[model samples]
Target: MNKYRITVADKNPLVLSGLETLFKNDDRFILTGTARTGAEFIELAAQNKFDIGVTGWEMPGLDGRAILDAIGEFEYHPKIVIYTGVPNPRIIREAMLNGAAGFYAKGDSTEQLITTVASVAAGQMVFPYFDLKKLQDDPWESLTRRELDLLDYLKTGQSNQQIANYLGLSVNTIKFHLKNLYTKLGVKNRAQAVAVSLSRKSNH
Candidate 1:
C-alpha cells in the first residue's frame, strides 16, 4: 500500500522532531516535510504537493490563519488539518471558518490524530459536530494579516498618514488595505472599524 504523504508546520523544534518520529514509525505514513514557521511551510507547499498539511495556530511569519489565506491563491489547495495545543473556541472557530477541514486539539489521542488525517485526506469535513451551531458568525476570522495590522494601528488612533508611516506602506497602499479591511470588518469607516477591532481585542 502507498503511504499517505504529510507535511507539518509548528514553531517548536521538539514538536517537529516528535511528529517526525511518529510519522516515521508509522508504516502507513510518509512525512514529506516539516517546517518551523508558516513562511517556510508556504514555500515548501509551493514546491511540493502533499496529501495533507497538519499545522498549528501560531507560527512565525504568517499565523495559521494567514497561511490559510495565502494558500487560497494556490492552484491546488491541500487538505489542511490544524493540530494545535490551543483549544480556544475562538481560534477553533476561526480555523474552521478560514479553511481547515479538521482539527486535533493537543489533548486528543494519537489514534485520533491518525484517524483525523485519514478522514480529512479522504475529503471529509470533521468537526467536533456539537460545536458547529454554537460557533459565532463573526467575520473577524476573515481578516488577513495586513488587514489586521491596519486595524491594530487604527485601534491606537492612527490616521491614514500615520498608519502609512508606521507600517512603511504608501498611503495609496494603505487606502487599498483599508478598503478590504472595511469590508471584512463590516464597517463603513475608520471609527466603526476601530471600535470593532478594540472590542474583539478585549474579548481575547
Candidate 2:
C-alpha cells in the first residue's frame, strides 16, 4: 500500500511529539515533518510534499487561515486539517470556506483523528458536528472584535471616516476591516450589516 505523507503543526510540543509517534507507528501514514509554529509549518510545507497538513488554528506568527491562504501560492497544495483545541462554529465555517479538508477537535480520541485524516486523504471533508442554522442565524460569532466594534459604529450611523477617526485608524484601514466584516456577515454594504445586527439583537 502506498503510504500517505503527512505534516503536523501545533504550538504544543507534547501534541507534536505525540502525533509524530502515532503517525510513525501507523504503517499507512508517513510523518514527513512536525512544526511547533505556523511559520515553521509553512516553511516545512514549502520544502516538502505532503498529502495532508495537520495543524492547529491558533498559533504564533501566521495561523491556520494564513497557511490555507499560502497553499494557493504553492505548486502543490496539500489537504489541510485543522486540529484545534478551540473549535468554534466560526472557525469551522472559515475552514470550510478556505477549502480545508477537516476540522478535528483536539479533545476527540486519537482514533477519531486518525480516521479524519484518512478520510480526508481519501477525498473527503470532515468537520465536527455543528448547527448550520444557528451558524447562519447568528453570524455574530464569526465577527472579529474589531468587526463587532465597527458594527456598533455602523449601528450608530457613523460614517467610515468618523469611525476611523474615533478608532485612530486610517479610513482605508477601516474600509479594509469593513470589507472583511461585510464578508463575514454575508452583507453587501453597511445598511445590510446594520440591519442584520439589529435583527439579531431584537431576537435576544
Candidate 3:
C-alpha cells in the first residue's frame, strides 16, 4: 500500500525544517516536498499529485488562502490544511468556506497536529481551537445571511462603495443593509459595528 503523500509550505525556514522532521518520523505519511513560497507550492502541486498540502496562513507571496483558491480550481485538488500563527475564528471560517479541510495553529501541541492531520486525511473536518457549536449559538443568530455578509465586509474595513462592488449590489442597497446590520448589532458606527460583531463571534 502507498503512504499518503504530503507537501508542506511555509515562509519560515525553521518551521519548514520542523515540519519536515515531524513528518519524516511518521510512518504513514510521505513528506514529498517542502516549499518556501505559495508560488513554489502551486508550481509543485501543478506538476505532481499530493494527498494533502499544509501551508501557513501568511507567506511572502500569494498567501495560504490564495494557494487554496488556486488548488480548488485545479482538476486534481488535494485536501488542504491551513497551518498558521494566527488563529482568528473569522479567518478559520473563511478557510473552511474556501475548501480547507482543517486548521492548526503554529503553537499547537505536536500531538494535536498529528491528530488533526490524521483526521483531515481520513476525510473529517478538524479545527484546532474553534468550537463550531458555540459559534452557531451566537446572539447574532437573528441576523440574516445578507446582514452577516455586510458585517463581514465591514470587518474587512471596506467602504460602502467597495462592499457594494464586491457583493454586486448598488451602493444604496449596501447602505440600506448596513443600516439594518447596525441596528441588529446595536452599534452606532462602522467601528462599533465591527467591534460588536467580532466580539460576539469570539465569544462563540
Error of 1 at 116 (Å): 0.8
State each model's CA lDDT, in order. Answer: 0.82, 0.88, 0.83
lDDT of 1 by residue, 1-204 (tens): 767788988899988887788777888778889999999999989998887898887888778888888877899988888888976666776778788889888788877888888889778987664354444355665565578777878878888999899767799999998999898777899999988877877999
lDDT of 3 by residue, 1-204 (tens): 557899999899998999999998998799989999999999889888899989987877677667888999999879999999988676687688788999999887977888898888888988756777765565474465467767888888989999889878799998898788777667788999888867877997
Candidate 2 local accuracy as lDDT? Answer: 0.88
> Top model by lDDT, which number?
2
A best-first ranking of the candidates according to their TM-score comes to: 2, 1, 3
lDDT of 3 at 167: 70
After TM-score superposition, the amount by which residue 28's alpha carbon in candidate 1 deviates from its true location, in angstroms, is: 1.7
Compare candidates 1 and 3 on lDDT and give the better one: 3
Q: How do the residues 1-204 of candidate 2 rate in per-residue lDDT, one tens digit apiece?
A: 878999999899999899999889999999999999989999998999899989998877777777788876898879999999988888898888877999999998999999999999989999888988888777676665467778889989989899989978899999999999998888899999999889888999
Cα distance off (Å), candidate 1, residue 49:
1.7
Cα-based TM-score, every candidate: 0.75, 0.76, 0.66
Error (Å) of candidate 2 at residue 43 is 0.6
On a 0 to 1 TM-score scale, where does candidate 2 land against the true structure? Answer: 0.76
Predicted structure 3: lDDT: 0.83
Ranking by lDDT: 2, 3, 1
